[model samples]
Target: MVDADQTFVIVGGGLAGAKAAETLRAEGFTGRVILISDERDHPYERPPLSKGYLLGKEERDSVFVHEPAWYAQNDIELHLGQFVDRIDRAAKTVRYGDDGTLVRYDKLLLVTGAEPRRLDIPGTGLAGVHHLRRLAHAERLKGVLTALGRDNGHLVIAGAGWIGLEVAAAAREYGAEVTVIDPEPTPLHHVLGPELGGVFAELHREHGVRFRFGRRLTEIVGQDGMVLAVRTDDGEEHPAHDVLAAIGAAPRTGLAEAAGLEIADRAHGGGIVVDERLRTCDPDIYAAGDVANFPLALFGTELRVEHWANALNGGPAAARSMLGQDVTYDRIPYFFTDQYDLGMEYSGWAPPGSYDQVVIRGDAGKREFIAFWLSQGRVLAGMNVNVWDVTEGIQKLIRTRTQVDPEALANPHVPLDTLTS
Candidate 1:
C-alpha cells in the first residue's frame, strides 16, 4: 500500500479528476492531494456546456464542480493552465509545464479525458469555425450563435452524434439557421440503431433544422479567413456564417501511451486499458472516466462510456481501488440528454447489436415512452424518453436481468414495478 503521507496526484481538470479528488478527501486520506488541470478554471461538468450554458440558461460558476476556494480549504495543491508533458513511471513522478516542474506521486490517477475529433478538411482552421468541447469554447459560441439566430444567419454543423444533435437543437433554439451534415443515413445510427436514431432525426426535422445525410464532408469553404459554406462529397454546398465540428471525441491517451501503459482498442474509441477496479497494468497507476476502457461486468463487454454518470460513478470506484479496498466497478452504464422539449435517460449496455427485440411503452409520436432492448426476453438495455422518475426501476430491471413479457413491458396500464417485482 502507498504511504498515506505521500502525495496522491490526479491529472485533468474535468469532472472525473475532480470527483476522484473529492473521493480521496471524503474517504479520510490524510495524504497530500494534487489536482492538476490544463484549463484555468476549476474542475467543471461538460454536459451543461452544450445545452443549458450554451443557451444562456446557466451561469459560468454553476458549471464548476468546486469553487476555487474549495481546493485551498481542503489542502489540495492546484496547478492550472499548464500542459502535462510526460509521466516518468520509473521515477514515480509527473513532469509538466514549460518550466519542467517534477511532482512525485505515491500513486497517480490519469483522468485525462478525451479531445474533440478534429475535421481534417479545408476551412476548419478558418475564423468563425468552432469545436464545442470546453467551457471557453461554449462561451465563445453562445453569443455568436444567439446573434446568428437573431439575424437569421446560417450555421453548419459537421457530424451528427450526440454533440452535433444537441448543438443543432440549441443553436436552432437560439435562432441560428441550423444544418447538420453526416455521412450516416441517420444521426446516432451506430449506437441507437437505425429505428431509434430516426426518431432523433425526425425530432430535429420537426424543429426546423435541416440535415444532409449520406454525404461526407469534403471541405469547409471560406473567404477572408472566415467560413462561408461547407462542401460535401455529394457536391452539395451548405451556406454558413459559422460552423461547429462535433464529429465525436478521441481519448487523450498520448501521456499514458508514451509512458508505456496498456492501451485499449482503437476501434472502440481507444483509451487506457483498465480492469474492473479501474487499475491499469501498472499497479501504482489507475484510470477512469472517458479515458479508461474498463470492463462492463453487466453486459460482459469492454466499453468506455463518455458520459457524465460514468465519470461520477467511476471516479469514486477508482479511488476505492487505489485505497486497497476490495472493489469491483460493476455499475451499469447510464446517461441522460436534453434537446429542446425532449429529455431522455438510458441505462444498461446493449452489447454491440445483441438485442433481439425492442419493446416500447406509451406513444412514440407523443414523445413519451420507455424503450427496452431485450435479448431472448432478457432486458439488455432500457431508455425512458420524456418520462419522469422511472430510471431506478429501469436500472433495477436491467441489473436483475429479468426476463419479461413484451406485452407487459409495452403496457402502460401495467406499472413498471409490477414487471420487475
Candidate 2:
C-alpha cells in the first residue's frame, strides 16, 4: 500500500526526472522525494538548447522546467551538482557525491539521460572546439557565435544530423559562415533516407550553409590552444575559427549497468531496457526518458528515443506505473525540427529500410509538403514540413495501421482522417 513513509529517489535533472517528480506529487504520493543531478542548474528542457536558446531568441531562464522555488515548495529534496556513482540494489540505497552520501529509497527512477559523443580526433580540447548537450555548452556557444558573427569567422561542423544542422542554421542566422561535413551522401541520411534527406541538404544550401558530404573529419588542426581548421579524410583542409562536434549522443547507463540491470544493445538504441510499465528488471527500479529503451506496441519494437516528446510523456507514465497504476507506454515516436524557414514534425518510425516508398502531398519545391513513409501500403511514418495541426490525423493513421492508397495519401484534397478509416 502507498504510504508517506516510503521514499522515492530520482537520478538526473532533465525534463523526464522533473516531470516524474511532479507526477509523483500529483498522484498524492506523500513520500520523501529526492532528486539528484550532476548539473548545478535546475531541471531543464533540452529543445531550446539547440533551437531558440542557441539562436539568442529565448532567455536562458526560460529553459528551466520549473522555477527554482518549485522544487523546495513541492517538498522535493533537490541535490544539485551531486554525482551518483553507485546504486546498491540489495540495500535499496545509492551512494552520491565525493563525500559518499547515501540515500535510501523504496523506489528509484533513472532518467540519467544521454551525453554528446565526443570527437575522437586530436585537438578536441582546443578552445574553439565545442559540443552542445548542456545549458553551459549552449551558453558558451552562444557567446562564441556572437563573436564569430561579428568577426565574420567561419564555423565547421562535423556531422549532418539534427544537432549539426540546427547549430548550422543558428550560426548562419548569426551571420557566421558554416560548412557542415559528414560521411553520408546527404544530410539526415540515417533518419530521413536519401529522398527526404536531399530536401534538408537543399534547404541548408539555400541558406548559405555549405555542405561537404561523403567525407569525415580526420583531424582538428589547432594552434596556441585554439582551433585553426579541420582536415577531412580526403586531405582537404577547411579554414575554421571554430569546430562543433554534432556527431550524436549515447545514453548514460553506467549506474544502471553497475546495478546489473538489463541494457539494450546498439541495435535497440543502447539504453536501459524497460517493460511496457517502464520498470527495469528490478521491480523497484524504473527508467524513463532518453536512457530508457521501452517496447512500442504500436511499432512492435523496442526503441530508445532521444527526443523531447519522449521524455515529456515517458516521465509521467513511469511515475504512474511506479505508483501501482496501470500504464502502457505506447506513444508514437514523434520529433520536430526547425531549420531556416522550414519547420518539420515527424510521427511514427520510418528509419531507412523500414519503408518501401515515400509519398508526398503538397509542393516539395515550395517547402510546404507532407511526406509519408509507407511499407506494403501501410503508413509507417509521416512528416509535415511547414504544415500545421495535422499531427493528430497523422498519429491516428499510424495507430490504426491503415493501408492508405498512395494516390489519395499524396493528394492534398484528400483529408488524412478519411485515410485512417
Candidate 3:
C-alpha cells in the first residue's frame, strides 16, 4: 500500500475522475487526493441530460453521482470552478488559473473528458443555438421548451448521433415539431452497422421526427440575437425557433499535449492515444474516459468511446494502474441509450468491416429485439433494442467467444443461454 500522506492530483471532476478518487479510497489509499474540476457543481451524471433530464423526467439532484456530503466523507478535496492551466512534469505540479496556485502531485490522472464540437458558422452565437454538453445546456434547453410549448415551437437538431436523437425524442414528446439534420446517411452508422442504423433511422421517423440526412448545416439565421432559422448546404432553410448542435465531441487534450505527452488520432475523430493499460507515453501521467483512445482486446484496434460505461469502468482501471497495480484494461465495451421509452444497449466490439454475418433475434417491428454481429461464427458484438436480458446473454457470449448456430440465434423460440453452451 502507498503512504497515506502521498498526494494524488486528479484533473477533471467528471465520472472518471470522481470514480478514480472513490476507488482509490476503497482500495485503502488514504492519501491526500484532490479533484480539480472546472464546473461549479460536484461531479454529476451527464447521460440523462439529453434524455430524461431534458424532458423533466429526472431531477438535477438525482442525476448527480454523489452529494456534497459523500465527497467530504471520502476525505477528497473538491476544487470546483477551477481551471487547470498547465501541467509541469519536471516539477510534478499542476498550475490553476483561478489564483495561479501550483499543487504538486506524486501521481496524476488525466480524466479531462471532452467538450462539444462547435461549428464555425454565422449566428452560432445566437441565443437559441445551443450544444448539449453540461447541466447548464440542459437547463437552458428545458427553459426554452417550457416557454415555447411543443405545438407552436420548432426544434432543429444539427446532428443525428445519440445526443441529437435523444434530444429530438424529448422535443417531440414535449409537443414540438422536431427535425434532425446530419451529414451522415443514417444515425449511429459510425457505431452500429448500416443495417441497424437503418432500423434506428426508421424508428425515429415513425415517431413524428423529420430527418434530413446527408445534408450539412451551412449557417444559422438569427433575428435580434436569437435563432430564427437554419440554412443547409443545399440552400434549404428550416425555420426553427431552437437549434441544437450535437455533432459529437472533441477530446480535452490541450493540457496533456502542452505537457509534451504523446497523443494520437482517434478512429472516429479527435481523441488522444493511450496504451492497453490506459497509460500515455509519459509513464507518470495516465489518461482515460472520453479523452483516451485505448486498445480494444476484442477488435484489435485502438478506439475511443464517449460513453458513461467507459468512463465509469476505465477510470478505476487507470486508477489501479496509477497505483502500481498492473491491471489490463480489456473489458468488453458496452453503452446504453434511453430514448422515448426505448432502451438501447450495445456490448462487445465490432470494428468496421469486421462482421461477416448478423443474426436478428426478436422482432424489430415490435420495438424489442437483439441484433448480433458475428465474425467467424462467433458473436463479435450485440445491439439490444428494449431487450435487456438478450443483451446480458450476448455480453456473456462475447466474453466467452462461444460458437453458436446461426439458425438457432434467429429463432425466438430458443433461449439465449442455449447459444452459450
**Candidate 2 on 1-421: residue-level lDDT in tens?**
7799999999999999999999999999999999999999999999999899999889999999999999999999999999999999999999999999998989999999999999898888888988999999999999999999999999999999999999999999999999999999989998999999999999988989999999999899989888899999999999999999999999999999999999999877999999999999999999999999999888889999999999999999999998999899999999999988899999999889998999999999998999999999998899999999999999998899998899999999999999877
- The 10 consecutive residues of candidate 1 with the worst lDDT sum are 347-356
Which residues of candidate 1, in runs, are more than 4 Å off? 1-3
RMSD for each model, in Å, please?
A: 1.2, 0.7, 1.6
Model 2 misplaced regions, further than 4 Å: none
lDDT of 1 at 360: 86
Q: Candidate 1, overall lDDT? A: 0.89
Model 3: which residue pairs collide? 150-175, 150-176
Sorted by TM-score (best first), the order is 2, 1, 3
Write the residue-wise lDDT of candidate 1 on 1-421 in tens digits.
6566888999898898888898888988889999888998889999999988888899888999998899999888989998888999999999888899999998899999999999998878999989988999999999888789889999988889899998999988887899999988898877777768888999999999999988888898889888888889978888999989888899999999999999977886589999988999999999999999988777877897899998998888888788888989887888888999999999887744788798889998888998888899988888899998998888888888888999999998998888878
List residue ranges in candidate 3 displaced over 4 A: none
Give one digit per residue, the lDDT tens place, for model 3 in 1-421: 5788789889998999999998898888988999999999899888889878899988889878888899989899999999999999999999996689999998889999999999888888898888899998899988877766634788899888899998888887777888899888888877776778888788788888899998999999989988899999999999899898998899999999999887776544456677888888877788889988888766667778888998999889988888889888887888888887789889987755988998898898887888889999999998888886666788888988888899998888998888887
Cα misplacement distance, residue 337 of candidate 1 (Å): 0.9
| Per-prediction TM-score | 0.98, 0.99, 0.96
Best by lDDT: 2
- Return the lDDT, model 1, position 61: 88
TM-score of 2: 0.99
Model-by-model lDDT, in order? 0.89, 0.95, 0.86
Ranking the candidates on lDDT from highest down gives 2, 1, 3
